[model samples]
Target chain A: MTANTPPKALAFDVFGTVVDWRTSIAALVGQVLSAVGRPDIDAFAFTDDWRMRYLIGMRDFGQTGRGFVKLDILHREMLDALLVDMQLDLAEADRHTLVMGWHRLEPWPDSVEGLNRLKRRFPLVTCSNGHIALLVNMARHAGLPWDAILGAEVAQAYKPAPAAYQRTAQALDIAPGELCLVAAHHGDLFAARAAGLQTAFIHRPLEYGGAPAPDLQFQQPWDYEAGSLTELAERMGC
Target chain B: MTANTPPKALAFDVFGTVVDWRTSIAALVGQVLSAVGRPDIDAFAFTDDWRMRYLIGMRDFGQTGRGFVKLDILHREMLDALLVDMQLDLAEADRHTLVMGWHRLEPWPDSVEGLNRLKRRFPLVTCSNGHIALLVNMARHAGLPWDAILGAEVAQAYKPAPAAYQRTAQALDIAPGELCLVAAHHGDLFAARAAGLQTAFIHRPLEYGGAPAPDLQFQQPWDYEAGSLTELAERMGC
Candidate 1:
């Protein structure tokens, strides 16, 4: 008898795995900073700094155990603080418009094509730390046709927590074994695997600024590792 | 000086309002009953019996106040219980497939076109008691392009609770005034208004079966009322 392993759903890690967040944010920050007469400012650094506060804001809520703040709000909070610290003065309306840059992120080259192919074979969705609104807006802007959008904001527990992954399967009414986590980050796949989900590692070597690094190599322990989502879909026999 | 109204995000009620749940479930029930040689079975009674348990399941979860459960899971529980009471026997695989019918409900005739028009100018999303995954799957199945999906599952509280609408706005990072609850049910809009949201009542008369008595007739102090989403979209200038 063939022990067929069927994944009821495939959940993706969005930031670097699906969309090039580093490059996308850098472009947006560069445009905004240049417009505001700060041409020499390090846009990449500015983006990274803004994102660093993301975890901190979530941790504040996690510690208080009172409220769950969506990532878009947390991003805005961080952006406001960072702008003040960087000694920049911008109008309220302009700042609000700039904050929406996250909604306009460009998907990677293979994202749309690969996702469409995979969608024919499995239920494809996002399981990311980004809030539902952010993911939805990003999908709309990028023209990504996702079956569903799942996020930590819905679970109120960020990744690396089993609750996040387990809750996704529970919400979909699929068993953990019937779900696969597709991510570029080893840590994310490790967390998903620990939660009983199958893992598919996608290599996004340039995720941390297109610099050469050791961790980008395909990890063998993963059930599947591919150079890109195109290869991943092909390997999945989509 | 311009007297500016607050930005409004349209929060829709799913289930019977957007989709003809009665017809969908009745068809499926009839099909299953006929296939099982129980041709004379009362499908309407079965559908209602299955639906009544929905609120009971939510109330039970609320009563326990422990971990949360999604609507799909709750529906499965109810379906299994009802199937037994109806003296029906279904295979495990068939039972799973039948439970997934919620994910495949068709939209009302005006749903897609109306939502598309409205979405051109407004942030449109679901504010249903169903879980995020349930709503998302339904959207994909029905070709309903929602800008975002919000639900009582997000707040761990069901409709009629103020927290449901309040949490939806918080998740979107929009003020309560910016979220207008668009629903057929008076009680849902009443709860939304109580929680400080704008209210638009759409007439979905056949939600509970037969010709629905016009519940919110004669304007009723709402921001707007329309016969269908097409009319609603025109009123919103979309």
Candidate 2:
């Protein structure tokens, strides 16, 4: 298929695009802090620190020969480090609760209904950094209707690496151009475009929660751009 | 934790367990034969030949040093060789139609509703030899509500190989015994059990059409046995 063959499938970037990870994660941290008798800790700052480690971990691990670690493992690893760095003490069960809380994330209000609309027209699969088990549990918990959960673990590489995008397209048996990457971050779409995938920008302004989301602004010439997933459904004629 | 924990997810075997490929492929072969003015071809025998080659292909491809190949490509490859062996001259379009027909398979009458019921109780996934694309298309075509599609392509090994079942359990973040494999074939269930998975035997009496399915007899010690997908749901308390 040529570059203009209307994408046969929509590969989604799940973390911040489809779900309110910042708010959900902050809530988890806040709960843990309160339970541990240290409620004064800034939950958003802790979440941001953990997310920063996660991003850096994915970048370094994907580029190295570390050979595919699941995002759940990385998340727990980051959680452990942050606990030490922040000088917090907790029982093993609470620590486990904090790390596994990712599986209980809530969807952005418009994500589910809009995705339901989009699914009527396109096969919806995740091309997220989250591994299959995490995505499956999140889908079950958040009522996200993913046709398939695929990405980093299956591709053996994380996003922003060309293999991550190219391999996802290959998995769906479609030309890169025939599989559109629907992602919130500009860096993700840039890498997808570089890998010859069509790009659709879905704005998730509150992804960072009270911090400037520099990537949330519309980048020029994306195949489609919408403020909410519901708007994306309207734009896609779903 | 232990061998007795209830399964966290249900991984299904698609081919003869969820859909009647013998009947479906025979119908496709009959159409192609009629379209080529060779209606005398025994479509059932032809389908059996194609299936035999397919089974051999998967067995060899999975165990060999040959890198991962998607089932779609393998299906097309087998279709090409079968046409040559049968001395049939089908146009490229007709050849494509026959191979791609696997994506459009008709589910057994009980599959959709029963799977829907099961999905409410467990995260449903496919552990078929079919690749993600094939399973995604088949689910869309047949209304199979799979939360994830994973198998040969993702695991890089086919069923009866230890890696297939072991890797699926790992991908789900569950112990091998925590993933119940629901399949019709004893070889598949036996391998799964060997890999420490719980097994649910599904009886597809008409899978072989007019031929006897020797493995259809009750093999003792399966975790559960049911006559149909609906019955499996009932037995699983879905």
Candidate 3:
């Protein structure tokens, strides 16, 4: 967090940080819906609802002392509830396909190039709440060049939980200050900073895809701030 | 595993399978010894002794309910005992340098190219007894392009424990048969077979530095056997 001392490793927050979950999920869901005879349900609205429940479910689960469940399982539970509310009866395989959509989200356009650039300088790891398998699948699907995957699943805690930030540093065998969390969400940045991790804010204004929530606004000063990952790479001297 | 069925993912045993650890550790230790005025110590013998205790310590720790300790801590413990046995007192930094040698071990000559070739076809993950930080550092040092790092550390159980192999399969969301254990040691491959996972063997003859202990020899019927990782890649049709 100090000016002269640079972070030895950079931890990334995926989903809205590296990948475009909103548009990718909306498109993938519509295709699945078309195949499954449920094209009437709005894909974008469904994506919004699913995305909205993410942090709340994870936090509440941890708060209620439910020890670390993978986000994939949580997503499936949420999807099943939504399906029940809509009076939808889906095949098991179709339900699985819908849930597996999280594993195949597309990265932001600048993600691949920017990550490659930063990887050349510092070790790049995933600090997202997305579990290791989902992160790995998304990286392969999106061509994101992550050096290592560590975060919620590895730490057994979701972001904003101090354990998510601290345990990641422990996993990497680095001091919290030596690991920088690069995230589009202000809350994640705030949590990282509070956990003694260096913080970098990435502006992803369209993360909600014109839905007007403004998920990536720069709310406060961070160690570094940039409009895109490429800009972050440039600012970090990578 | 059935011959007709191909594994969905490849999990690698890193130390001897992917890296020339004996040579690397011997060289690194020799350098440290020479720098610390203990040039008379036998580096190869030291490396061999240190490596010889690896599996025993891991197995005993688990059986004795020590839980899953990271291999780095184990490595440090082994190095300290070896130091005491030799009556060699080293500076804290020099002692750390010797243990960190694991993180900088060189891969076999054929490893990088073969891994790059195989990585194109399968998601290559580490199934080594080494922990995540050790694996990540080694991968970076050796230029191994691993999709994810898992194994004893991630599973919190050493190899030969069914939990190690089963947990890795579960983490990838694949059936046990869909995961292949690619290792040089017969014991490791045998355990994988027992755990309902596929197995492949790659020869690494000089793993112990030619002190009359043979390694990397083709021993038995495996799902696949090859002279090198490149050959393994070819056998897998990668």
Q: Pick the candidate with the highest TM-score.
A: 2
> What residue runs in model 2 are displaced by over 4 Å at the alpha carbon?
A1-5, A62-64, A214-219, B1-4, B59-64, B214-218
Candidate lDDT scores, in order, read 0.78, 0.86, 0.85
Cα lDDT tens digits, model 1, B6-119, are 346788998777888878888887888787788798988888788777756654555666555677677888899988997888777766766778878988899889999987
Candidate 2's displacement at residue A142, Å, is 1.0
Q: What share of the true interface contacts does each candidate keep?
A: 0.42, 0.93, 0.57
Across residues A1-238, which tens digit of lDDT does each residue of candidate 1 receive? 1133868889999988889887888888888778888889998988877766664554355565655456666677788899899888777775776678877788889989999899878878788988877887788788777776775877678876788898888767788888899998877787798899988888887777766433334245788888899998998899
Model 3 residue pairs with clashes: B204-B216
By descending DockQ, how would the candidates be arranged?
A: 2, 3, 1
Q: Rank the candidates by TM-score, best first.
A: 2, 3, 1
Q: How far does residue B20 in candidate 3 sit from its true spot (Å)? A: 0.3
lDDT per residue for candidate 3 within A1-238, as digits (tens), equals 2374899999999989899999988998898888888899999988888777776676466567777777888899898888787787888998888889889988888999999989989999999888888888888889887878889888888878999999999888899999999998887888898999998988888888755553345367888989899998999898
By DockQ thresholds, what CAPRI class is model 3?
Answer: medium
Query: Candidate 3: deviation at residue A145, Å?
Result: 1.5
lDDT string, candidate 2, B48-77, tens digits: 888888877765665567766777778888
User: Candidate 2 local accuracy as lDDT?
Assistant: 0.86
In candidate 3, clashing pairs total 1
Residue B163 alpha-carbon offset, candidate 2, angstroms: 0.5
**1 or 3, greater by lDDT:** 3
